[model samples]
Target: MAHYKAADSKREQFRRYLEKSGVLDTLTKALLLTSKDVVLVALYEEPEKPNSALDFLKHHLGASAPENPEIEALRLEVAEMKEKYEAVLEENKKLKTKLAQYEPPQEEKRDE
Candidate 1:
């Protein structure tokens, strides 16, 4: 019975130490519910810490989670624009090649 009591006391002491060290603060936990970018930055900047608000935000929000529908729509529009741009670039290359083939080469003059 005494051995069990000693073990329980040790566990309680550890829990108190964690809380006092701000290892489980509310803001840190709330950040977890917000975004992952914050978490990644924290991880890179504070490699030694076991807990980071940034990581909590990232873990809860996920790194790839889009914040708004408008942003997502804009991303899709940008991708479509890039595809169109690539097609135009290909066409331009072909047109330039054809033009070069049709043009006559200039003759170089020799110095007397």
Candidate 2:
């Protein structure tokens, strides 16, 4: 069934994520790989409702969840940097507008 295949695919994806997260040691990684194959077999036998592999991984891994901490830190840093950059840009724009306003306009040339 399509559902069975999707579940199997999700299990494989979770295994890959476990490997990629870099939080697992060799023993744990190997165990997870083995468990993934077992899960695939179980799902093929009896498929369950579709669930987000990312969410499942995040829940299981807790503090070791991929990208949460790092992303939060980067987001904060980016927000601060963007705020500073925008302030400078706004100031520059205001100065340019003031300069243009103060510049004297040329008079129209008289016809010969």
Candidate 3:
């Protein structure tokens, strides 16, 4: 009985030491890393089926989308808008270059 008690006391002391030294915290972190590893392994074992999600999206969108004629009109409008945007960007760049041309040139110093 006394030997058992001594062993129990040593066990408790070791437990306290582990707790005080942050061993338990480290052990918990290790367990969390292990759990993440397991999740990664599962993810790598089987690729995600992205097509299913895309199919779901297509099914939902196909129901609500406008007819082909309307889509064609929108495509033409987008093309026109893109052309206008490019024209504006070209005008902006030309204006910047023109402004730089109007700046006074630095005077060269003559050597004495």
Candidate 4:
């Protein structure tokens, strides 16, 4: 069914996102740390629950998770760059419109 396929596709994308974010590896390591004080098998068993998984990981793994101050700085830089890029694009559009106003229109050619 199309619905099932779409759900499967979303699952695949989420799996890839988790893998790329290193969440999968961290969760695995945490789960393997069953010999330690924390019991992280809940992460594997209750992943279907809607909650802050990253927050959970950060709490248990401390600074080992992907998020940090350096990443936060990079994210802010990216957002600033995007804002500047949009502003430049708007200026470019306005300049092009002004230039078009000063130029004469060209006649279209006929195929006769």
Q: Which candidate tops TM-score?
A: 4
Candidate 3, residue 8: the lDDT equals 89
Q: Which of 2 and 4 is ahead in TM-score?
A: 4
Summing lDDT over every window of 10 consecutive residues in candidate 1, give the lowest-scoring window: 103-112
Model 4 reaches what TM-score against the true structure?
Answer: 0.43
Ranking by lDDT: 4, 1, 2, 3
Per-residue lDDT tens digits for candidate 3, residues 32-97, read 565444533432343442323323323433434667898899999999999999999999999989
When sorted by TM-score, best at the front, the candidate numbers are 4, 1, 2, 3
Collision count of model 4: 0
Between candidates 3 and 4, which one is better according to TM-score?
4
lDDT of 4: 0.67
Task: Score each candidate by Cα lDDT.
Answer: 0.62, 0.60, 0.58, 0.67
Steric clash pairs (candidate 4): none
**TM-score of candidate 3 relative to the true fold:** 0.33
Q: Give the residue spans of candidate 1 off by over 4 A.
A: 1-55, 59-66, 108-112
* lDDT value, residue 112 of candidate 1: 22
Tens digits of per-residue lDDT, candidate 2, 14-103, equal 567545644234335445666555544443344442354433433443435567788899999999999999999999999998997776
Model 1, position 99: C-alpha lDDT score: 95
Off by over 4 Å in 2: 1-54, 57-71, 106-112
**The candidate that achieves the highest lDDT relative to the unseen native structure:** 4
Model 4 lDDT per residue over 36-81, tens place: 2352444444557325556556656564556788989999999999
